[model samples]
Target: MKIHVWNAFASNNSGSYTIVGRFPSEELAAQVAAELSEVLAAHEQWFRSPTAPRSGEGSRRETPSPLRAFAQVHSLTQGESDWADQGELRAWSTGHQVFLHDPCTLSLPDSYEEFLRVRGGKVETRIRHAHADIVSLFELRGTLPKKTKAETVRALVEELHADDGPLVTLAPFNLQPAWREGSKPGEPVLTVGAVFHDRDLATGFTAVEGLARRHGLDVTVRVSEEQDSRDSLAWLRPSHPPLKRKMFDVWLLEAGYSPKEVARRLGELRHGRYVDVPGLLKALPDTVLKRLTLSRAEQAVRFLREGGANAELRPAE
Candidate 1:
């Protein structure tokens, strides 16, 4: 578990400050996120965002020379003790990322701006490089409960046999924080020891592992938790037929892809070498079946796959 803090605004031009961390495993991410809540508990006005909004505009242009947002009271809203508000501390897990956002705000910037206004003024309006309270931590905590997060991480035996997605998330916040020699500085050490639905676990996990492998980073799973999942409930019921890749993740690792590879990236489930979409665009492509929003990610991937399948029948480019 690790915590990375930046003493400035986050994306979406939200506020002028933030804390962050990335994990190869969802169980680990949940554990660290839970611990962050403990950090917030210990230090008032300190909230965590699964996804931070944009910043660096408005008066926040200048960096805070002496990072003090965490120690200083940012807003009256921060004074309000409302932990249960799905909006206040809402953690939304989508596709391959578990982001924290306030339901009350239309976007991340809304809440961030509130924090900035309450603190004093906007970041873009500032004229100097302020002290940033940023901290970044990159730690790899090996596998869990044998099959702790992975229904069968123990049975895994270096081979895939299950159909769970690459990503799964736990609301450690739903549970209490239990720390041991905090992994990041000025942050409590914590882990998600409870049980929660494995939402997008495969998706998130594999995406992470893929990046690690491509970069030659050594990693493995070691895996918790019961908590409400309304925030990411809809995702569990993906518009698609719960892609079989979840099932393939297990077998793929055994078939040859390293466990890290299985956890890090993805191809279409049915194809030994299916198309890999640019994960950055976590939306499904526009199709006749469903058109939730104007997104071309999934559509492009499909075109690539179907187009390749018929490439032999067509003339070479």
Candidate 2:
């Protein structure tokens, strides 16, 4: 097998270190990424950030934790914890690279892509490093002749990707298509709670605290003292994308407004789009509301119900 390496300066952390390749087939490349998980782990050698978050941080799982993301996954809580891994891999080049060297003028990614464009090879792979002191990534700038599978990339692989904070992290073992991920950066999130048995509030808080300590996240855990009460929820993330805001943007787009126009209008109204069905109805003057068809509003906010309870508006701590 022939091997080539290039430097990737963008993702320098252990979780950022990765093995990537373009196989003759996408399926084959995926398999190789899976198979080599173990082999790469064996080859990895470096110290990195601990898996646990810093004093107050959150968990970051773009993909599942390394064990789940790779084959023959092991863990400190599991056997074969000796595996090593540096970072995540992208089957497709991220198209982000910078060169800081003499002769760097023409030897840039634009030129590099031009070179790869000429090579007809169909497969590729790269092994990355996790050492923070190291400022370069080991990458491949070309295609591969064929796909190859090997295993062994492991380490604080998952831990490296975890968030650094004091709040408890609680990512679903299997991430749902939850609204959390796609929200705008620094978007505020509501910490809503439900009834959990004849609960001592402390139990829920303690559990959530433990989870946060274990995973570093700004998550809040709440179990209302009132049984079967839907009155308990808190706001955590500030500047968070409200469900109503998203609904409004989509609605306006369908209403034949350009995205730019919709955004401009929302800004003029101080995020007028960020409202639930009732809130939206109440906010609009009857004259304007009458002009807007129910069908159109419903289309924009899928959750627009004729009558239903909404999450209580609890003041954030």
Candidate 3:
């Protein structure tokens, strides 16, 4: 059995639902689902910002959270897991905007295809044009006051609006297609959300707080330094065309990452990807270690340990 995190989006009296995550166990699925729930609850009003003032609706009362999106845990038997087998693996390379799928019930009419080919590996959709389907995203990490949340987001949107839309950060989970190509395009992708982009924008969105002077909305935007690995490893399987260090630009090499070594070691992993030191550091525990023995294979680990000399080390699992 597999557990799935089902997400639904609603606006203008219509909405759609799809699976965002599929986990082998209920624990992880529940965790992800709960996180998404809290995120949407904290930030939903941001998506529900009025395009124009509404007339005669009595007094505006705060609606329950998730006015535009909702998420919950879903159970599936083995037979229902067949959708995972239909798609081909695609390597996620940087330098292009990849649109996985827009599950937003309020998005503009889509301008991209909605299918995956077995050999062609068009399983993932990425576009090159800047204005085609690009959007800025700012994932909110904390809660906000319900009374002022809508106004807070309105100010944010107004601040971010240059031509397209404001940079919005919703839940971190990726919504999987309700059904791929050959099947009809799901209603979820029909309309554009106030702001929705399946992937992170090439640029960052950290300057939101300074835009407005008054509202104390607690929003934290986390922009991953390693977008290449973040995008490629977001899904649950191996990539078809393996990612290599050479595929990355010179900036990474100039930043002290060993390109030749990255190229060599990427091929060695099961997924042909590398999770850098900073990523590993974030996942490590805060407990400090006295003296730990290391193996030759852990030479890199030894090198890192030598730097802090007082750094913590979680025991290897």
Worst 10 residues of 1 by lDDT: 246-255
User: Per-residue lDDT for 106-150 in model 1, tens only?
Assistant: 222233334433423332321111122111112223433423423
Q: Give candidate 3's whole-model lDDT.
A: 0.27
| Residue range 108-192, candidate 2, lDDT tens digits | 1122222222332221332223221111211112221222100001111122122321111221111111112122334322222
TM-score of each: 0.21, 0.18, 0.17
What Cα-based lDDT does every candidate model obtain? 0.27, 0.25, 0.27
- State the TM-score for model 3: 0.17
Supply the global lDDT for candidate 2. 0.25
RMSD values for the candidates in order, in angstroms, are 19.5, 24.4, 22.6
Q: In candidate 2, where is summed lDDT lowest over 10 consecutive residues?
A: 148-157
Backbone collisions counted per model: 80, 44, 10
Best-fitting candidate, scored by TM-score: 1
TM-score, candidate 1, is: 0.21
Cα deviation in Å at residue 47, candidate 1?
14
Residue 73 in candidate 3, Cα distance off native in Å: 52
Q: What stretches of model 2 exceed 4 Å from their correct place?
A: 1-26, 44-317
